[model samples]
Target: MKNLLDILSNPHKRMPLDTLMKCEVVLEKLDFKRSEGLPPSGAQGKEQIFNPLLEVVNKCLQSPLANHTLKRTFGSTLHALNGPEIKNLPPPAKIAKVEEPPMEIPDVLQGEIARLDSRFKVSLDTMQTLGSEGSISLFAELQSARLPCVPPLQVFVPRGYPAAPPAASVARAAHSKPDHFLKLLNKAMDHKCARLPKNCSVGQLLDAWEMSVRQACAPNATTANYAPVPALGI
Candidate 1:
């Protein structure tokens, strides 16, 4: 026992594999002998707390079985033995959660953002840059038209865009779709390059679907609205 205590006290003493096994056996035998005297499974008093009990605790902690159920039982016994005196150990500190940094907007894409904000009156509130190459989301709401709006639609614009038309679609359901919002996405898309003047923006293709939604849902849109009928004599 003195050798074991000396070895535990000296950091330089590396116990051999066989000696470590012997130490575990000695601790188990010692615990089995003293467990009968501890608190009788519930009661605590002056008789229960003693130096010999704490010596068993240090032994149990050093044993190879420290992570097992037997070690857990020993831990409970140790806690009872120490009682209010356990305040010597400080409570553990909590770790705060780390959040991802804000998304970045590119210098080249700033022009596109400006065009949408100034001309269409859409702003960054409706858009998000995907990555460094100016890939972005188009806020699919009809800001000028007072209509039931769908969720924000993500427009995937590859590094080289407007050479080909951009694609748009709805986002994942927030568990399910938002109130009054339909999954009216993944619908067919087209362009009016022939009718419109040339050389505006290559990224203009990204806004084509947004324009179509605004035109179709506007209160005075010709297709979805009717002129007031002539009143009959009352």
Candidate 2:
């Protein structure tokens, strides 16, 4: 036992196979030296904690039939007779759970945006340069460009009646024949007949329809002279 303890206390004894083989050797040597009888069953008692081999010791001490089984033949021969049963050993104490510290998360979006901007090879200077080029012209050239100060506009607000809807007058004109529609069309095209493009079919059709109605009927256009529109400015 003293030799086994000395060998186990060495720092170099690390491997499981080495420890198991050494323990087997110790048991075998102890058995050869002692030659004790096998232990009986129900041998549980106090001394099994420090030297657990005592539990095996108690078993070898208690077995009745001396026919020499492994535990009876070998184990009784190994260690001392005063050892206790292994199953009677006390359980290890419960350990407390440890609480971990909180971790801080990094801003993933900011990192991704910065990476994208670098990969695209873009700078703020290029955006400002584009904005300056598209600005509108604020001043005209120093030439007498004849801007129309007075356009030919006649806005007459008569005494009291409201103007009839253009829709009603158009409805009446729509009932006319295709030939009458053509004469009014020819008159509207008198000056612009040569100037118009050959592909201006839609514009030509609209002018012809407008001329077809000689006078557009206005039920609400009439105004009494009593309620007059006062002139504001020329």
In the predicted model 1, the residue pairs found to clash are none
lDDT of 1: 0.46
lDDT value, residue 167 of candidate 2: 9
Highest lDDT: which candidate?
1
Tens-digit per-residue lDDT, 173-205, candidate 2 = 345554533333233323233333433322232
Candidate 1 clash figure, as a count: 0
Q: Distance (Å) between predicted and true CA of 70, model 2? A: 8.9
lDDT for 233 in candidate 2 is 16
Each candidate's TM vs. the true structure? Answer: 0.32, 0.14
lDDT of each: 0.46, 0.31
Where model 2 places Cα greater than 4 Å from the true spot, the runs are 1-15, 32-55, 58-234
